[model samples]
Target: MAGPKSGAYAIAAVPLLFIGTLLGFVIVGDEDSCVSTVAAGVSVTIDPGSVPQTEIAGYGHEQLVNAAHVIQAGKDEGLTVRDQTIGVMTAMGESSLRNIDYGDWETGGVINPDGSRTTSIGLFQQQDGWGTREERLDPYVTSTKFFQEMIQKVPDRDSLEPTIVAHRTQVNADPYHYERYWAPAVQIVEGLTGAQTGLGGASPAVCGGSLVPGEISAAGWALPNTGPVTSPYGPRIHPIYGTLRFHAGIDLAAGCDAPIWSIQDGVVVGRGFDRGGNGYIKIDHGAGIASRYLHMYDSGMFVNVGDKVTAGQQIGLEGSSGESTGCHLHFEVHINGDTVDPDLFMRQVGVPLG
Candidate 1:
């Protein structure tokens, strides 16, 4: 995710339409792209020191302060709360919400497409195509540059998933790389501002944060999906294999694109497609406990390899990807590396399967 780092809008006289519907916003840009903006006098401020906690989303005071700069940058661009959250999430994934004097070449060096070492630096990990080295090092400047790009690149971002919008803006290799930071970014934004935002309103059901939400048990467990269990975990004729085999997990039919929450906090140990091209996520929860979810489309996955996810945090959206015949989640619980009945295990942990 690298490019021009100029902070100014440079917005060429794009036409504007006054949307007098209850929310009253001025829509800027063309049909394919819409930038939601309030009246000129409306403004936002970010007080990093006002955050009650010294740490947020695993980041310390300095890092949260950097995120505040990002929020202010997005606000200055008149971006919605969701778009601002995307800005912060992108920075979190790229630079851990901190600015650095050097870039890709100095850290984990990588050759660019033209065979030159990557020049990615700053909060957005921008390349030389961005502004001067000094500009990229400035938080509000770099973040403003980022929001300007997002407004031009993302189409109808107000209706799209925040992670997808970030992916489109940054042009990252993995479309979902910014996903894990989403929940934390929402928390940081709301906590710092002390106001409920439109972050996840009308957005995809990602039970991470936003006006929507998630729930976890005191035992550190959560239901993957609150839908009905369509299939139990046990030995039976394989639905696709056509042979008598053990079904390693229980199947829950939660509608397509429904959020699939992680049942326990853990590191994502693995993710890959099955024979039918559907995807799966395996998390190791320690104490010999682990869980797996299957049948989501590749893009539906929210977290990635090595992402430390929390209980009830969204990990993926349900889909009929692999050998699946329809939309649902094939959820499995494991103990000591052996498959166990998820219904029984979750029930034991006070997170009974639906």
Candidate 2:
């Protein structure tokens, strides 16, 4: 088995200068104006409201979340956290967000006379056909060896491209497969914490719900409607702004005044008019996560900021609210202070909205 410490260096070596630089950029304002500071070899400015609202969860979303947990777990096990992105990208390409226990048909490996042992297993899905059963389940053992092979093979570390290239030198699989998923993985990382601490001992955020019993998504665990999702989450034209901005939430497109429900039970966080002149609702699902219901025509809100709600309970009427261009239900799922695509979690429960 590879010494556990070997992998830690791989992950730790890559300084998160990219994230630090990005944050500095976000903090700095235009030089022509005021509110600027020069410090520590860089300039710093602040934009009070530059943080964008985000939503649009999908397979990519889950992969990012899982990757963070995996990274942290690796660190706890005395494994390197650096250069581990290669394994992450590979996992994202192979299984999306799920910690799959089985591999695909083309994903070759182990074999059993009954045709069972060959199944790809666990988060990285090492095949029993290639290794012992114990080895496949131990993420640290599998991931460490994988990284050892990658670093020894690849010469370039300055860019993600060559790093990934080096990692997959033997697969003969498309080198670009892991590269394409990088951006989406980063997006999930940003939305979750605005930082990359990985699982490091940070408890998962507990979101809306009364059960408080089991681990559920920081995003509410239920859908706002049993009705099919009318529009998928992603890039869409702002009906009012007319500028292209990301659609942070999925639109249910339910009939106006129809009963709308909460995904996971939580407390009413806010209910009132948004700057756009449409009535809106915000629910605090706990653990710094919240849900929003927008475009209600009526002034009466079903819950208050502190009022607890049950999952799937009627929370409001679906109507155009807050600068809305039409009479459609606007919904949002937020983690910490950032919005993530609700569709990602929606798909987990097999909700058929879209």
Evaluate residue 101 in candidate 1 and report its C-alpha lDDT on the 0 to 100 scale.
70
Candidate 2 Cα misplacement greater than 4 A, ranges: 1-221, 349-354
TM-score per candidate: 0.47, 0.36
> For model 1, what is the C-alpha lDDT against the true structure?
0.70
Best by lDDT: 1
Error of 2 at 51 (Å): 50
Clashes of each: 5, 25
Lowest summed lDDT over 10 consecutive residues: which window, candidate 1?
4-13
Worst 10 residues of 2 by lDDT: 1-10
User: Highest TM-score among the candidates is held by which one?
Assistant: 1
Superposed Cα RMSD, model 2: 19.3
